[model samples]
Target: MQDSPQQPGSTGPTGSTVTSVDDPWVPSALEQERAAYRSARTRRSALVATASTLAMLGAVVALVGSSPGWPRVKETFFSWGKAVDSFPAVLDGLWLNIRVMLVCAVLIAILGLTLAVMRTVRGPVAFPLRLFATAYVDLFRGLPLLLVLFLLGFGAPALQLSGVPNSALFWGGCALVLSYSAYVAEVFRAGIESVHPSQRAAARSLGLSYGQTLRHVVLPQAVRRVVPALMNDLVSLQKDSGLIAVLGVIDAIRAAQIETASDFNYTPYVVAGALFVCLTIPMARFTDWVARRQGFHGAGGHL
Candidate 1:
């Protein structure tokens, strides 16, 4: 059997079955002019932006090049030969930073979410949990991350407990997880509380328990709401992972330090920095893209 043809009056060109394409709507001259004007305006704005950016960059380059210590600065910090020599080692060390960031990110998310839930729990019975969460957040959020790293990385190893590993790397990671989780817990809590109370009531009305409502209804929305914030924290984690180097972990910055010690040239440090920029810029852009796509911006239209 052959399929029937689509009648012209049955389906319009726009694919609406209620109308025919026999009389198609056309843009008026005013609408056509408006569209052309918009296109031209966009092109002009882009051109101006490009020219201004290039001019600003050129000015900065000229200023730097004309500095009194330009040659010395260039030789010490931007030598192509040194960069080439350090690239492999720096890249290898950066892998450690990446791994640390990945592991710490996962641990941060888990601990942070747990803390958020703990803080948000109801009832007098859960007051202890709320107090503990509040105290933990206040303590860590007030302390500088570097100090925490120093205390844990140096002090933990000094204690020499039999069952515990005293490695600086382990303690450094613990410090990172502890410090970062506090900030991330606030982000999670903000997201969770931003959720309207009506949602919980609705879920409960449908016979869901509090835990079921949180897991299925509240959390999904909360997590989605704070995704950009979480991603920003992850980006911060990537850069801050280098701080583990101060604990003697041989991460990218530490490797750069050792390389710099060989000849006192800072080019290896610059190389390490460039590699981190390479790592961070993409993630930063991706976070912005996620933010835009989520419709927080006017561009995404309240998605």
Candidate 2:
């Protein structure tokens, strides 16, 4: 028998009725959108991961090449196995550097403090004091420290200035103190000036003397402001102490040079370099800490 005609709302094949032509079997709009988003995110994540891996690999390669060599470098740089057995010889020169630096630093600090005070003082005597300080600073700062050291160590004998003969240690140390004192004086002056003007005003308003105001109120803040600068200068001074070797005052560098001359190897210089780095690193870190404490973020702030 022939099939009957279907009605408008009748079920078709599989007993399912279509609602609209827009509905299709492939996917929903929201599902399609979600799939597209996932694919984009996956692609972006893969690209980023690849870039990061490349960067890390490059850094590793760079570090590997930069290192002189491992076992060979250890032997060449430190010579800890055989060369370090001669510890007394190495330490002798190190001790000399320590002594000279300590003595010169003490002298420099005293002289620098005096010069800084004189620079900031007011009166007829103060003017001459300030002028002398200015000239000294300009002279020392303009001259090469090595040349000045040479002149002081060799030339001072002809002048016949009392009991001050041209002894290497004495003259070399004097030159170092003289050069460093000028710089340290400026550091001290900056530290003093960094104190708020209102502090002095308040002290004067309260009937405190100028000396009292500076001693009690101004110097403290100045010290805090100058600590980082002072620490940095100390580090520089430590490095500069090596210059004393030129005056025949055997420091670490000079000792290394003597060893290199005997052994015909550059290992001693490497050793000296390492020693200097060891001295300077802690000082640099301390300066960094002080700077951070004072709310300085290097030369520029990131955020």
Q: Which of the numbered candidates is closest to the native, going by highest lDDT?
A: 1
Candidate of highest TM-score = 1
Clashing pairs in 1: none
Model 2, 33-106: lDDT tens digits are 99999999999999999999999999997886588676566565566643564444556777787788888888
Model 1: lDDT to the true structure: 0.93
TM-score of every model?
0.89, 0.70
Candidate 1 backbone clash number: 0
Candidate 1 per-residue C-alpha lDDT over 58-176 given as tens digits, one digit per residue, 9 for 90 to 100: 99999999999999999999999989998888889999999999999999999999999999999999999999999999999999999999999988888888999988889999999
Worst lDDT run of 10 residues, candidate 2, spans 294-303
